[model samples]
Target: MKFTTLLFPAVVLGAACPYGTYAPEEPTDTRGVCPMLNTLANHGYLPRNGRNINENQTVQALYDALNLTPDFGRFLFKAGRLSNPMPNATTFSLDDLNRHDLFEHDGSLSRQDAYFGQWSRFNQTVWNWTTQYYTSDLLDVQIVANSRAQRHTRSNLTNPMYSLSEVGYLFSVAENAAILSILGDKVTQTCPKKFADYLFTNEQLPFAVGWKKSALPITIQDLVTTFLAIQSATSFPPPPPDDSSVDIFN
Candidate 1:
């Protein structure tokens, strides 16, 4: 049954966004830890209510909005599904993804650590700290990677309950990779810093900044290539060897 999911087709190039428009406003609906996911819900790519999102909705939302391949989109949905507690659940609400450390992790570039008690809210000061490394209008792989590494290191040192498992670390790096691949030129491995700023702060796509979905579908391989680049460039101290706690939320 699961194999049939691979048959889902990618969105056609230049296709109109079927999810309506990218409208940013204060959300009264359930939201999640990931800014990009919340932005998708806000833009109506996912249900604005952010509830009961099925695999089809998730895959289509990703493909239509970000030009991601359906397979890659499905992989993300499956990962989020790990957070849902319902037995044999095939759907998930955005809030269900709030379960820590599935993909959401500590040392977020924008959100506060879970220990701070407002882990889900976007903190402007934290965002400012992360963006300080982006001195220019453009952000390259190394810049993004280093910024993430620095944030992780800081969190490890200051947050008394800090914890990041291998899974958390990988997801953190992948989040950066997603931003670079979706907003910047995949070949050049760079994107306009303003585009990222608008997305992270306002929870909106930076269409006004001349950002458009990639012409070529963003494959898993595209993300993998960027992920590897960021990972290789990142230089941060390892967590304590005895740090066995697995749960984390940013």
Candidate 2:
């Protein structure tokens, strides 16, 4: 799963805003476990209130802000919708996405396991472990892969209740893929560690750091290929499913 070397002259880069401007403000309303989604809300790509967000709103926001293809955005939103407890609901608030084993899962890059509770907020201790691997300004796929595998290892040893289903594992891999796709340089195949930190710690896009939306759209195939690259760099047992009967995601 090697990516071909791509060389494109760096385009003049600045803050890429789908909304009027990239002014990130504290959300006066609820936020989700996803740092990217929360960042989108903070930047006014989605409703600042983070409430009653429907599929169309989410899909459009992803497209406008990150240049994610509409179909890929819809795929992500479909997984997110599963977290909502409401049956037959097409809309979900950011808070609704906190449901464990659905969209949010254990061994997050910056978040703690659900067993510890308060899992939505940033955890510095967990983050510190990951930061050690950010040895350079640019985080390549292998570096990102190592960081993710290390986090999973730490959680496996520390969190007694830590569990990740097959689906959860796939989502976990895709998350890192999304980060790289959204914030990394397409020609270089790496993301800025500074930009990654800003997104995780502040839950805001690093517009101040001169990041712009990728000139090309991020497709589902792009994400899937990155997922395979990450998966190859790490190994963990297929975790048993958590004992919860709610299987709405199927």
Candidate 3:
């Protein structure tokens, strides 16, 4: 993917607290983090799935599933208020891990957090090639928008954060578009033709491609399916070059 070096404004971004603090009044038997972890495992993103669906997700488990480093967690704590630890802390305690439902199955995921993870992952890939991804600066901007201004913007475009449904839609629209833009046509053409066509046709209307409306809560299944689809489309190897032609000079 092509990397763009954009100037990031030096601004301190505040973090927002999780959705809610109170324990849920009603909990369902099937509601928990296991399904999400299972989906990731099935997709080869995780090693195995032994977690119970009814149990809350731990900080370490989340980081592991997302393939994020401890430094990234510290960055999130410092920038997004997603987590809080003692000053200069490297790991999360049990209290810090269980402090919010955002880390649990019962709590819904926010569009901001979802965008943060997606962008971070993409930026990491870019960083592997070049040191100009501007991930930290962009994350600071997102934190400011998500927490201080109550808005979520990416690539300088304003987007909403109603729920996980919105997150899915944004991922389908903005995130995919950003990837396509960064990778350019040459790289994107390597993906399955049908998948590329689907993305092109549904670029504007996410619901047409199975993304639910913004009001509905996106299930773990939906999130996993979306990620799997993206992985299948974007992570495939390119076709080998034709070697049938003989060299005239040789």
Model 2, range 21-51, lDDT digits (tens) per residue?
A: 5455554788878888888887778877788
Candidate 3 per-residue C-alpha lDDT over 32-72 given as tens digits, one digit per residue, 9 for 90 to 100: 12222223233222222222211123324335434334443
Candidate 1 global lDDT: 0.84
TM-score computed on alpha carbons, candidate 1: 0.85
Candidate topping TM-score: 1
In order, the Cα lDDT scores of the candidates are 0.84, 0.81, 0.28
How much is the lDDT of residue 123 in candidate 2?
87
Alpha carbon lDDT at 126, candidate 1? 87
Where model 1 places Cα greater than 4 Å from the true spot, the runs are 1-18, 25-27, 237-250
TM-score of each: 0.85, 0.83, 0.20
Clashing pairs in 2: none
TM-score comparison, 1 vs 3, better candidate: 1
Prediction 2 TM-score vs. true: 0.83
